[model samples]
Target: MTWRARLLALDGLTPQLGDADRLVWTTLADAPDGAELVFLGLDDGRPCFAAIPAAGDAAPRLANPQLWGLMARLPAADLALYGGARSLIDWHARHRFCAQCGGDTRLAKGGWQRDCGACGAQHFPRTDPVTIMLVEYRGRLLLGRGLGWGEGRYSALAGFVEPGESLEEAVAREVLEETGVTVPSATVRYIASQPWPFPSQLMIGCHVRASNDAITLDTTELADARWFSREDVATALAGKGPFTAPPQQAIAHHLLHWWLNQPATA
Candidate 1:
């Protein structure tokens, strides 16, 4: 019973397992020293681990492709595991020293925590929460484009949740701040969530009802903001519209797809 190892590079690419049906696990004796190891639970009673090599050191025969490119190409389960692995590896790399006392830190709790040598403080990985909402008003959805997203790329409005604020509160605040559309607390509804691991973020998806269709775009935050009807959105999703929506891997796209299929209500 060989334990499976997924050797990930600093850039997040893993070794391709050739045409073999399963991964080729490198035993502890074969793993390189200073490689960050994380136990990723078990697959069919065999232990599965994610290994990240030290910076500037190459892993054996692994391709160095970008992780974002593999999201849609890999199976859902595999993608989820890779997301977790990438996040944990990134956290460890960034927290090599403790912030409290500027002391050295070492891995603890099976790669989930860091222990300080000087200050004796324990540090843990952080996951920032963000609220992404699809705002609706008068049978239309509000979309906005960030400053550098090119001419016609629009998606749901999102912002990080501030301290001491509820999810509903964050939703309303982000909507107003980015698009100047006022959404009351009662009209905000939670839909679903997705783990965004670019550097560890939990995206909370919601559908918000705007009090009015009027939009006042904040130029510093957004390049453009507008309300799109269901017909327009459907056309965009079908790749026939003037503007393009988010990609399939994003929660924004999922929220839009869900909203497009719902029956209109008074």
Candidate 2:
């Protein structure tokens, strides 16, 4: 994978595959003169590293994105490696200076940490916790499309887990705040989670049963919200109906799959 700026998870990137459809990587010794090298890890006894350009891109765009286009083509293991590299390198680029004492920080611990020389402060990569849920009322799933999503595309609702809040609490709070759907915290069920590489987020997936079905959309977060029937969800997943599903790489897609596989009485 090649990226000029590695600050954002959705930043512009194009993967390079050579020989037998594998990711093309360069060693630190062969890196460009101005490149920043971060130790990624060992792959089959040899150390892996990410060589980043010194002057990185500041802004990221989503128009005609190549990474998204090539995501499904690369092997799952390769995609995960690229995501990890992006998050680690991005953390380094964004934390060049210490936030506490205005001190210059140097890369330490093989790209896992930063140490402030002036203030003796240590900074580590941040993995923000986020709650993403499939809100259900009766037998239908709640889905919404954000302003930035493509036409007719929708996915599960999500929000950051605020400080001092439990995962269930955050889920209930976010569902209420963004869509005016009251989810009882006790009813929120924990599902599998995915590490969202968009600037490093741990997406905690969950689901809950809602008693009411009315929606009062928070325009700032969602352009529209509605309860989708089980059949509507199945059609969307098949890529031919009520709405388009979220990208396969996203947890939302899996959440929908999980929902469809449950027993009829569940």
TM-score of 2: 0.90
**Which residue pairs does candidate 2 place in steric collision?**
5-57
What are the per-residue Cα lDDT tens digits for candidate 2 across 151-247? 8988999999999999999998888888888989999999999887667899999998876777888999889998898999999899998999988
lDDT of 1 by residue, 2-31 (tens): 444434332333433323322234555555
Question: Which pairs clash in model 1?
Answer: none
lDDT of 1 at 49: 67
TM-score of each: 0.86, 0.90
lDDT of 2: 0.79
How far out, in Å, is residue 59 in model 1? Answer: 22
What local lDDT does model 1 show for residue 183?
A: 97
Instruction: Name the regions of candidate 2 deviating beyond 4 angstroms.
Output: 1-14, 19-21, 55-64
Which is the leading candidate under lDDT?
Answer: 2
